[model samples]
Target: MFRLAHISDVHLGPLPAVTYRDLASKRVVGYVNWQRNRRRHMVDALTDTLVADLKASEPGHIAVTGDLVNLALDGEIELARLWLETLGPPHDVSLVPGNHDAYVPGAFGKACRSWSAWMSGDGEEGPVSRDTFPYLRVRENIALIGVSTARATAPFMASGFFREGQAARLEKILEETAGRGLCRVVMIHHPPVRGAVSQHKRLFGVGRFQKAMRRCGAELILHGHSHLPSLYHLDGAGGKIPVVGVAAAGQAPGGSHPAAQYNLLDIDGGKGDWRIRLTRRGLTGTALPLADLEAVELSGKAAAFVRN
Candidate 1:
């Protein structure tokens, strides 16, 4: 079985500690709010639990969907490498960059440079050549494609895109790799399809992404940037292709609530079927399955029965 684990929004490092310079400006209130409420929510603690639980699960592959850093700091990128190392090597682990990863000028570029120097692992730098779609790590019967949507934008905008360049390259990859019986797994930090949650947060090129994926056909897509559990199906890929969004593996700048969860995707290689199980990595280093969460499958696609 081609088992995989998916985690996202692991905003590692200590809780945000900030001092406001303006007393009456809204920024000051934001700083106070962060200190009072958000700073107390250390979702990164879930990473510890997740690492332990993942080791126990022993997934064949892992895909992380970005937001690895909190403030786009250089130190934060280093912290992301450390956190990713705890998961495993780059050959087994795959990742994409989120909006937060590119918040500052040339932040993504600098982080990429540093990660290549330190924790780029076995990650290939490109499938698009210009550094937008860095398709890497094709092993066994799977093609893991990672795209970069990280970009610096206005303070109010937190959107991502692959635009024409990356999207076209991805289409070519999918087409060239088709009928090879290779399970295609696309990874991005932003959701490529619109749904109920798209009301407030969404990827800028979601429609285009959908069009491309429909044209080329993908087995599954992994995403983050929305710190909630979401699963949906799209129209283009013959059968329903699943897109999943994982919860934060690190603390969020909100409260001390249980906003820490991730997904374990088990794909039976022989059967060509996949199932996703959601779990919450608790403080005591336990992976507890979220109650009532169901494993979804496309019509006529059966999951390998694993009797526990």
Candidate 2:
């Protein structure tokens, strides 16, 4: 069985010093919000503990869906790179950016440059850019597709965009991967399903995304950005595909958002008869040990049994 661990919206904290120029644009709003609210809840220590627990589980691979940094400041981006190194090497970890990584107009490009190793496709080399997304990485019998929905948005809005160009490319990738008889796992920062998040935080072009899924199905879809532990399904050419979201990895226990958590997916079998078991684990409180919260069989003859 291939064990894949999923984590997202880490929002790595302990804000780096910000210059006046950094605060001149939309970052000022994020800076203010972090100071007033986020800093209290997004604790670095919590993320550290969560990562340690995840590593102990020894997943065959790890998928981080985004929001690695808070303000997308140059310092924050650098710190995030260091954090990624501690998490695992590029071969073992795959990442996609989130809205916070592209908080300003050019921040996403900077992040791409710094985090090229984790985001690049197999055998892909040279400088990574924003356009390099929807990259493919094959591990064992699974095909991991990284899609980018992250973009700069206006202050107070956390929306993401899925343009037609990317949608077309995604459909092609899905088709090719399916033809290979590999389990296709698509990763995006924003949940593609409608109503997964509020209006200001919604992923635009939901119709286009659904259309692509209908044309070329995926085995599993993983996303972050809502900071809520959620599960949903989308219609696929073959059957229902599971879409999952997890809470922020850095969120503190007893905070406004759900506590830090990650999903461990055990995938076995092949092509037309895959078996998937999902085990959800995370913190229930500050003093309690990390523990299993839910376990369900996502595929096979049994119906999906999910708790919250």
User: Best lDDT goes to which candidate?
Assistant: 2
Residue pair clashes in candidate 1: 38-253, 38-254, 42-251, 43-250, 43-251, 44-250, 44-251
Residue 46 displacement (Å), model 2: 1.0
Per-residue accuracy of model 1 over 1-308 as CA lDDT, tens digit each: 66777878876767334444332233344344546655567544556766676667787887888877755666667777776777777667887788877766667786676554222324444322235454645667777878878886665456786788888888888776566667777888888777634544567788888888779877777888877667666655556677777767764434433456667766654324434443333232234532323455432333232221
The segments of candidate 2 whose C-alpha lies over 4 angstroms from its true place after superposition are 300-303, 306-308
lDDT of 2: 0.91
- Please provide TM-scores, in order, for all candidate models, with all chains considered together: 0.80, 0.97
Worst 10 residues of 1 by lDDT: 299-308
What is candidate 2's CA lDDT for residue 74? 92
Against the true structure, candidate 2 reaches a TM-score of 0.97
lDDT of 2 at 273: 91
